[model samples]
Target: MTDRDSVFLRALGDAASRLRPEVHEYVAGPPAGSRSGVGRGVFEIAGSPYRRIAGLLRIVSGPDVALDAYERDVPFEIVNRLAADGSRPRLDAERSFRFRRGPRRFVDTLQVGRIPGTLVNTPGTDGRVELLLECSVTADGNLMMQSRAARVRIGRRRIRLPKLVSVKVTVIDGWSPEHEHRTVDVSVRNPVLGTVLRYRGWFPYEYVPS
Candidate 1:
C-alpha cells in the first residue's frame, strides 16, 4: 500500500474506535434493541457471492454501538460526504450494522433468524445462523480481525469455514486533521474468498441512553 493509503487507513481506524461505546459506560443489562448504543452506517459493497453474503450480514447486525447519546449523535450526512469521492463505485447500500465491545475484544455478530426475501435458496431451516466475528485493536489503533477461528453457526451446529480471513479497518472521526466527519474504510478477505468485502462509505447513527 502507498503512503496515502496507509494514512487513510489509520484515520479510519481512529474513527472505528471512537464509534464504539465504552464498555465501562454500559447502562445496565442487555441492550433493548439493536438501535440502542449502536452506530449506523451505509456502505457500498463489491464482489459476487461475498457481496450477497455481506448484504445478509448487514440485515442481522443492526445499528452501530453508541454508549453515550451526546457523544455518538453524529449525522449520517457528515459520513456520507466524507465517503463521496471518485475513487470507488457504489454498488449497494448496507445500513445499520452494529458492533459490540467485550472484555477482551470487540465483536460483530449477525443473527440470521429468517431468510432474505431476495435470496432464492435458503441456507437452513427456521434455525438461526449467526456470523460471529471477534476483533482487536493494534497499539497503533488500526483495527484488526482474523477469520481463522470465525464461525458460521446454525443453531447448535458450529461451522468454522476453512481458510484464513483477516481485515484491517480504519475510521476517520471528527478529530481528524483533514476531515472533521466520521467514515470507515475496511478491507476484509479470506485466502479462498479473495476479497470477501471491501467498502468505504458513511451513514447516520446515534446513541441510545442506557
Candidate 2:
C-alpha cells in the first residue's frame, strides 16, 4: 500500500515521511521482502508495581490484556499486519510477553481517526477501550505519540471516561545505532495514580514471511 493508505501516515500527515527508516517501515507496511513484519524482543523491565491495579486492568481489559509479575529481561514476540480494510487502512498487532506465571498477549488495532491527523487505538482482547492519539515525527526521525482521550464500550453504549479513570499514554519509537536495533518505550499514566505502567526495550526486526 502507498503511504497515503497507511494508518500511521494518516495520523502523522506530512510528518510521516520524516520518521526513521526503521520505524517508518514498521508503521507503513507490506514491508519489502515479506508479507508481514515480525519482531522478537526482550523488555528490560516489564509490568506494573501495583498488584491490585494490574489485576483490575486485566479483568476489565479481558484476560489476554497485558499484565504480569514485575520482571526484567522479559522476552516478547510481536507480529504486525497492515492492510486495507475495504476503504479504510488499519494496523493490527499481537504482542506475546513471556512471564514467569504464563505467556500473556496484548492485542491492538489502529486506524485513521474521523478527525484528520489522528489515529484511534483499540487495545485489549475484547477492545472495550478506544483511544484517540496524536502523533508526530521528530527532527531526529523518532516517532512520538500521546493519547489522553479514551472511551469504553459497554454492550451497545460507549462512555467517555473521566480523568480519574482515563489514562494518558505516551509512546516513543526509534532506531538505536548503539544497540544496532530498534528501540521503544511506553508509559501509561493516570492523573491521580501517577505512572501506572512502563516498559522499554530494543529489538532487531525484519519483514518476515506471513
Candidate 3:
C-alpha cells in the first residue's frame, strides 16, 4: 500500500475502533476501485451496522478538498433545509437523488419503509435486504446516520445490496448549524462518495484521491 492508502486504512481502523464491538464485525474493506481520483479512500459500513446508530462520521483528515467529487452522490441540500426550518418538505419517498459529476449523471431512488424494531436476518426478495436506521441530521447539515450495533450472522452467504454510505456536505446554509451530517443514500455505484453542497443546482465537481 502507498502512503495515501496507509492513511486511509488508518482512518478506517480508527473509525471502526470508536464503534461498538458488535458493529465492528460487519465493517468491510472499501470496495475495490471505490476510491476515485479525488477521494483519499472509500470505506463501507454495512447496513446492519448502520441501523444501530443515528449519526455518520466522515473521516476527512488527509488532503484538502478530499471529498469534493462525492457531493453529487447524496441529497444534502434538501435535507439541510428540512432540518434547519423544522419544515418537512414533501419528500417523494420515491424520488431519487440526481446529480452530475464531470460528464456522468447518477440517479437512484430508495424504497422507503418503516422497518419493525426487530433483529432478524430475513432474505430479501430483490436480493437486497432492508435494515432499519435512526438517521440524525447535524447542525452543519451533515448527516450522522448509524445502525443498531449488533452482530448479524450471514452463515457464509454472499449478498449484494446498496448499503447506506456517508457523504460530507460542505456548503452549510446560514440557517444550518456547524456540525455536518454523516448522510447516506441507498445507491452505491457513484464514483464520487463524499462531496456535499448547500443547493440543488449543478456545479463543476472534481476529486483528486490522496
Candidate 4:
C-alpha cells in the first residue's frame, strides 16, 4: 500500500517528525546496490545448566517483534528513530515498537514488549553463535539488556532463568564519506562465560516499494 493510504505509515511519518532532524537523514533508505557495511555482536552463555539452555533456546527463537515489523514492511525511519536512542523500541503508544529496519537486515535493535515494562532484543549472527538479547535503554542513551527475569521459549513451553547475563549495545553514528553517517558497536556477556559474540560496522540501505 502507498504511504499515504496506510494509517501505519502516516503515524510513522508523524513520529519521525518529532525526532531530531539529523535522524531524518538515516531514515531515508540508501541508494541501490550500495555497500551496507558490517556490524558485530558478542554473546556469552555461562552460569547454571539452565542459563545455558535458556540462551540456546533464545538463539533458536530469534527476534519476535522486530522480525514481525520487518515482515510487515514498516518504514525504516520510524523504526530507526525509536530504536536508535535508548528509548523503548515501541512503534507507537498502543503499538510495541517505534521503528522498523531496512530489508538488508542491518538493524541491531528489536522490540519485544513485556506488559507495563518494555523488552527490546538485539540479535546478531556473526559466523559463530547467534547472540540474542532482551534489554532496555539507559538514561545515558545506551542499549542495555539484563539477564534477570530472562526466559526462553521453544514452541508453547517457556523457561525462565536467572539474572547473571546481560548485553550492552553502543551505537556510533558518523558520516561514512560513502553513506553519510552510520556505525554501531554491540557486546553481550555472561559473567561466568565472558564475551561470546562481537561486531563493529555499518550497512548502506534504501527503502524499496513496500
- For model 4, the run of ten residues with the poorest summed lDDT: 39-48
Q: Assess every candidate by TM-score.
A: 0.37, 0.90, 0.21, 0.39
Model 4 regions more than 4 Å off: 1-109, 115-117, 120-149, 165-179
- The TM-score, computed over Cα atoms with residue i paired to residue i, of candidate 3 is 0.21
Candidate 2 vs candidate 4: the lDDT winner is 2
Displacement of residue 40 (Cα, Å) in model 1 is 6.4
Highest-scoring model, lDDT: 2
lDDT of 1 by residue, 46-152 (tens): 22234335445434332231111111222222111112125521111223332222111112322211222111111122222223323344454434333223344
Q: For candidate 1, give the lDDT.
A: 0.31
Residue range 71-163, candidate 2, lDDT tens digits: 789898888887667888888888888888787677888888888777899898688888898888878899888995999888888789999
RMSD (CA, Å), candidate 4 to true, equals 12.6
lDDT of 3 by residue, 1-210 (tens): 222221112223334334332122212212244332111111121111221121221121111111223343333221100011132111111112332433211211122223432112211122223232333333443323333321222445533323334232222111211232122333212124432222232211122232
Which residue runs of candidate 1 sit more than 4 Å off their true CA positions?
1-134, 139-143, 164-175, 203-205, 208-210
Assess the local accuracy of residue 158 in candidate 1 as a C-alpha lDDT between 0 and 100. 59
Clashes of each: 15, 0, 32, 29
